[model samples]
Target: MKPAHRSRRRGAPAALRWPAIATLLAAAFATSPPAAPPAAAAANPASFAANCGTKPVTLQGYFETGFPGTVELTKLFTKQYPNVTWKIREDPFAVITQDAPLVLSSPNPPDLMRTPQITGLVKDHILLNLDRFYKIFGWDKFPASDLEQLRVDPSGRPQGVGPVWAMGINYSMTGVFYNKALAAKVGIKLPPATLAQLDEDMAKAKAAGVLPVEQFDSAGNGGLIFPLQYLMADYTIAASGSVQPINAWVLDQPHATIVTHANLLAVEHLDQWIKDGYFNADANAVPYSTMMARFEHGQGLFIFDGDWESGNLDHNFPGKYGFFLFPPLKAGGKQAAMSAPLTYGIPATAKHASCAAYFLNWVQTNPAARALNVAVYGSNPGGPASLPIPPVKPGTVTAQTLAAGRVIAKEDGAMGFIANAAGPIDAEAWTPAVQKLFGGQITPQAVLTTVQADYEQELSAP
Candidate 1:
């Protein structure tokens, strides 16, 4: 979620404007075809032993504030390679999105920075093309789907083909995190298997004076988008048997639209949830942190969030929470969730690209680093599918989220965040539209039409 600080750097280039960036991207793709993936032998594990070299070096990084997993991983990296230290800068997710193009264009950019949307940055020739690193590190060995989200075609669309631009320290998944004690109070013997059962449970919680769901809908962040997208995925799958339409829309495929019948049904469901008071009364005012705090304090029965918080919940409130994918529409039906990497990339002008690439590869393959990813971030350390997941303690929230991630993988139900449909789609479109829905100012159909209109305008900007 973007914070209130949405300022851009002074005197930034006009070319950096998102619409202009899109135009430039289309031009680039038309004239110069994207390079094919490099061919190389599998990277040997022993090769990483000295990938960073013996000389003293310091890596510059820009990371999202409040997530300690990346910083903690950097410290671990330095521990193994004492000569390599880090000088890091931090910002909230929204700030990073606004600043990414400017920073990547700077003469002195961070060696490694958190990447937001790639379509613009890729087309502007600001982000380093990691096709070479892919071969050098034998990243091809990882599951194809694991890397697909990071791939972009010549047309700047994410078709899971073409050169790889970034790599994930760990892949994150999203779902429902419920307070276990509250579940027993509501007589929910097990997590709901169907949406109807979930609705029934939330009604029970409300009857018992419990907040049925604690989600944030604050302007800019619009945390409600989580459940809305989850519902869209469920409805899409129920109708079409796959999430490709939603994924294609998010990947910016030509002629893609979110105004389908399934999506309309999804929005109507969320509108009903709003009308039924399933969400917090002050949801529109709550931010991500406040919502998490409220849930942790037992102020609500459930929260929709990503696996990134699993470790924090396990550590702070041990044995108090349980997680499940948003229930499917029918018993034993397929499930889906928003899952993507905490992507990081090097600037085209970065000074230590090689060492930075080494660090990225190590984060996934090194036993200690992979363990830190699981233990600290509670995410899958994405590497070769053959590399077993680090053992998680039973009964921990991290364990449940990890298990849920496997369910998503097996079902092929992963969908990118809908907010990422375009550069400003989250803040300028979905956030405002959904907030209006919560305020009873807009109908369910209006929510879809409004966002789709905004999406078209942004993508077609001159």
Candidate 2:
């Protein structure tokens, strides 16, 4: 399940205020092509010499859930800098989101933590500014878009453009996972190329006496939000003529709101999917884990989830499932997907702050670390420069997932995950509003208006 968005109540005035709606719209629909990806650069491990002074160091750290890459990266770091030791702990995402501020404020905060709830953490001055580190490591070599995910204004709100406050260890995207065996059973020879074709395939799956999609709604909005946001991202592009506006809105840019026509179309499409019997009848009753279990057990033809599940799916199903981007609404439309960084930041009061910075710097340049991120963790290492494209092994779901990430990167097709916008806008508003729609208690239009109301309230807060 996605973690709930968190907002900070105590902060100086926002460093980046909301942009005017007109400005946001113009930028979103701007026709200019994105800049070219930069050439790869060699990392200077020599620059880290000053930080690795002749002192014995034990670095304490925490991470959301259990990302094995953290352990692998830590081990790799210590091996290279043998003077340093690591004491790492793990916690569930919800717990981390709620407790990070308190933990960071303590006199003995972990030296480093996987902090995805950056809006609140940045605003509250819990994270150390990495400006000097960024300069030393030449981390600005990363794609501007990749770096933007880590930037926040001085007031701590996510500005999508400003000082770098954090960096992502892995890149993740939202996409469609299908049961290859079931696809064959339903006579689907190739993945659908358009939304209409996807709907047709879903109809076939339903007719073949299988659940068309495995989704969960019991604990929260993962079931609804994931696929719906995928559609919302695509629809935003189709409506506004580019994905920039949607990214702006999702990054909490000034004047961005959820009550847009694209979002309305996304919700309407979801309602139509439900009415067409594309989802499980027990969708409202099942949790996301159960849904994945059901999908892995071959109870559904397809599942909507993130790349984080790729490792699990590969282990359990092997060649059984295939991963693909969600087909566009129309032929040749943008192949938009929800994406964000598996980001981490250092606490200002961290005891071994330099060691933490060295580790972050090492992640992007070390081929072994990047491979572990992909092969073991099933994540795209959002490093400064691209790694050699791994050879695709046929029938490997992870290979396909990495391929999808490459496409997103090459095409500049990632839009922010909707829930990353704000707490009130997503967890407090969209989640329940979607549940209401799923339960037949409200309409798609109601979902739009309700979320917009909460978004406005959040922006207007003191």
Candidate 3:
């Protein structure tokens, strides 16, 4: 059964105007794009009006929305412009459904919102389009694959193109985190290298009184589930070399298959695991910390979450924490491909477009910030972390991190999409389905009724 969680999002307030330096584009440039794209928009980086009344630009946003990189960005942002006072708000991921309508309509709509690549933001027209801006400024500093990942429509356009909205500051990849001691205690000599083998290992662990896996709550800690779902989809995609949408952009594309039978096959695999007790009974209700505890106590063998959990592995699980890909169904799929490293979201009313863009651009280039951020997020070094985690591990998530960098120098952004970032469907809609699939309340077929219906509706809606 799913565990009890706190999905409450009662205090999610919209953006409040600040009294700092907010660069007004209209006044700044005589020739900047008049409004959004297709207006034969004026060029960006347009000079702001000297009359640019420097107001106290109060940035309304959250620090805990995505991964450690975004969190790192927040820290760096405060330092960049000490004069800009911030009224930041951090809330649960489910709040997208909890308070989306309220904030979208309220007079004091947040100047900026930190979302997890949600769909409704586009369907409801709540977010500013950054496609033109990102291109003009060159967010392509990373990889083409990474850029494509940002464009979840899978039809070959970035999420910011038009109806798509909300780019990421950063995102983590999904993977399998395991405790070596638990593997030994359960009499397993090796971690499974394939999805089938993973299931086999889980069954063995369960028979020996160990929980095969520790999955977080579908409510409060739900974002952690992305890895499991990601893997399931990947298993099928590997066979076909196809990408599915997690956002609504798939519908916008002339020809895109957001929900295919093969895609549904992935959901079925997860459903079978949940039904067979691979996860904790309280999997749907357990918070991330609680699941981590399971691994620490050596009662659980593995974790289905992001690579960002690496730093916390040692102290949390204690004995030995190792990482691996999602265990593909196909023998040799590029298991190295990850969901995302991290991406940033720039606001329409950003006062420091140049500064923000520069900061983002600098983040990709600067080693210190990227290194520091990777440490905090507990993720392995990707774009730049070429070596490995240092030996002197600390108790905090930051200390047990990798030293080498894994920065995507070639820039291949081909991440599929996060359901939250995909379509017009509210991110929460998948929860009940995910829950039902596990609890035996519904079959994967039943769950797809909602999943497919939503995917279709979101795709068709204006």
Against the reference, the lDDT scores of all candidates come to 0.87, 0.78, 0.52
C-alpha RMSD (angstroms) for model 1: 10.3
Q: How do the residues 343-431 of candidate 2 rate in per-residue lDDT, one tens digit apiece?
A: 88888777667778877867766777777777766767766665564344566888888888877877678887777776446668767
Cα deviation at 406, candidate 2, in Å, is 1.9
Task: Estimate candidate 2's alpha-carbon lDDT, on a 0 to 1 scale.
Answer: 0.78
Off by over 4 Å in 3: 1-44, 48-61, 65-87, 95-113, 118-138, 149-167, 217-231, 242-261, 314-319, 336-338, 341-344, 380-414, 421-428
Q: Quickly count the clashes in candidate 1.
A: 0
Candidate 3 lDDT over residue span 1-462, tens digit each: 133233334333334223222335445675655443322222155643211124554555543454445556656766655654456676665664466545544445554555545344443444444555455445544444445444433232334343224444444555566777778888875545667777788899999888888777656345433543555456546655534343223324444444556656777777777768788788778767777776666667887666567655654555477655555565654343345535344444444434444444445445565565555665533332243333345443334223211321222213444454334343445666666666678776666567666755665554
TM-score of 2: 0.86
Estimate, for each residue in 131-178, the C-alpha lDDT of model 1 and write its tens digit.
Answer: 877777889899888888788874565446788989999999999999
Clashes of each: 0, 2, 65
Over 4 Å off, model 2 = 1-51, 389-394
